[model samples]
Target: MSTADSLAKVIATLDWDGDLGPASLAVDEAEQLRSRLGDGATRWVAGAVEQSLTALHGQIHDSLAPWPIIRTFTRHVLTATLLRLADQDRLPVDTGAIDRDLAEDIVARGIPLSDITQALRSMQREWLSLLIDAALGVRPDGIGVVPALATSVTGTMDAWIGAATDAIVEERRRVYLAEQVRIRSAIELLVTAEPVDVEAVTQLLRIPLIGWHLSCAIGVPPGGTVERRVLDGLVHLFARVVGSERMLRYETSAGTVHLWVTTDRPARTPRVEDLRVPAPLLVGIGEPHPGPDGFRRTFLEASDALRLAGSLGDNGGVSYGDAALAIVLSRDEERARWFVEHELRDLATDSPEMADLRNTLRTFFDTRMRIAPAAERLFLHRNTLINRLDRIQAVLGHGVAERPAETQAALVLAELFTRRPEDPSTGRHEFGA
Candidate 1:
């Protein structure tokens, strides 16, 4: 065969799917090429190729370190490609196997096709440059054959990459849809208030079966977008702060995020002020409790806490610990209102006189209704505190000194009922007192 015909036939050898016998290339043609190149030339080229591949692997590693599966798979495919080329006389290149496995790895790792494409292009460029230089060193006149070699190498690469890219895209879509279904199913099981198979759930979610769990319910303002990476970083941050690994999260159709984090030991759970999260996100963290029952309860607690968070002050995350009583009372609006009116009378109204009385009462109760501590807390003298207490008794028709427990409860209900949803800081003196 003419030189052109021979090179064309060699290129055709790489096009086989699974019919590679012992070698991908024809024996006679391989022998002829080896003879033309000389054995020493083949050894030198293979060694250079190996060193070049190592360097390229390092570069790929740096670029795709975040995706370990893709990084590892790319390295494997490069090594396998080198092996096929080096031993073309005895082994065939099964590009199909490489393509299939690479595609699967990409999908499983959640890597984008664009990233894989970029890596392939980088490898193709490096391989072509190294191979062409090796070819020129072996045969000065071999420059003419470089184009054919390039076409053969790139054609095989393009075929495999194209197929793998398509396969991974389709697989990723399938997995994404399947994952959404799984998330929905898991949520239904959690919120139905029925008995759930906790073991089955733990196995399915790959989370701890029982541990101290804190649930956080996060809601973004309308028109705000929560990217996946941001959410991932936030979850990692929470894990670090809480010191736990058994964490699970779900995003609702309403664009709210629910997270359940489990820890082996329960400490004083951190408040939202302690966590690093977006300012626009409204967060409510539940008290940490143990086991699957704790998991369900904490979720409910966080969800409920989020509702009353706006009235607590600041858009920062609210903890159930601080807002639980207010949240509970606020659930029944009419009852809370009625209780506030009957118990405290006009003290429930928003007015300067009512504010002075509420502040004094709050400080009085917080200080255990002590005459001295209440005076100190209110920054008032003993005589002034006495006067305020008398005025408070006149308004409520009961002396403050008589009903300490009932007085405290009434003060709390008054604060809860009078809380302005738009301005959480309205009753700060009353709350803090």
Candidate 2:
């Protein structure tokens, strides 16, 4: 018989299902390795991944494949490689689904094709080493079949690589189209004032709309750029801070990311300091409210807060509560600007002296117009505090306490709308500095 017929006859005679051939021996050796490792299949696959990664360490840069994904892929490849060795004809290994999944992961993670190919080649080497060693020990003339067995392994790997590459391309296309659809759906659900079918919107967005929602908006300043990985990291951090897992996100082309954390109970506000937000990225969070309307309301609130942060030119988290009054006043920015300029007159000018006076005035209001307390808080002598108050009154030509409500509103608008030079020390723009 020819070599092809001889190889086919040998494969047919082998009891692939029984615990007796080279396949069984290779499996047993792998199991023994697993036993020696003492952490079950995870550790076994991790060993293979380590070897593969080590082989491609300097060859590829910026590998985004997570460890869990690598471990799962390694396990699948190991199983499929051994199975393909024993049953070339009746290859029961249906790795098509897993191959597609792996392809999607690779595309999502930005893992290079070469990295995957190199890893597969490394696995093939390991599998061949184990199987050939077993075959030589079990069969009398196993050396003669080595060439055919090697050929089979190579063919299997080549087919897998081809399939994976095709799947990767398809996944990339799917991801782009899916993103476009999601963006359109999100805009309809969140941006429009018109009512929507809540159930349909929820199903389309894959998020529940019938729970308490705490919304947040995160974005970089204009002319700044952020990566998707950075945004995803921020989302994970925010989820941890809020202690919620049910999160829904909508990312825009402008690099703004809006998300909501939902719960059965009322969501509590997260501590801003605990966020430890990085520089150049601002976060705005809204108060928790219930139901679908609350979801949209909180999203708008968060967006308003984000705008407040941007206007302040500060790279930090801002809660809706922090900017609530300003947001209300700035709704009609033209009128708000007029009110501020009219109320403060020359004090609204971007000047250091005016900023100091505003700070004192804000502190005085915070202390409920108590001179002693305000003076103490400002670390000023009682007479010095009174003198500054007198100066502030001079600028407005009225007593600071005369129109408390209107004065406070104007102060908030001025603080938000006034353009000041950047403070190098704090990396923020002061009210009027």
Best-fitting candidate, scored by lDDT: 2
**Local error of candidate 2 at 155, Å?**
5.5
Candidate 2 segments whose C-alpha is farther than 4 A from its true place: 1-187, 419-433
Model 1, CA-based lDDT = 0.64
TM-score of model 2 vs. true structure: 0.59
lDDT of 1 by residue, 192-250 (tens): 55577888777777777487788887765545577777766776777678777777877
Instruction: Note each model's CA RMSD in angstroms.
Output: 10.8, 14.4
Give each model a TM-score.
0.63, 0.59
**Span of 10 residues, lowest total lDDT, candidate 1:** 424-433
Off by over 4 Å in 1: 1-150, 221-233, 276-278, 401-406, 417-419, 423-433
- Model 2 has how many clashing residue pairs? 0
lDDT of 2 by residue, 26-85 (tens): 354455433432233323333444555455454556455554555555555554554455
As a whole number from 0 to 100, the lDDT of residue 380 in candidate 2 is 100
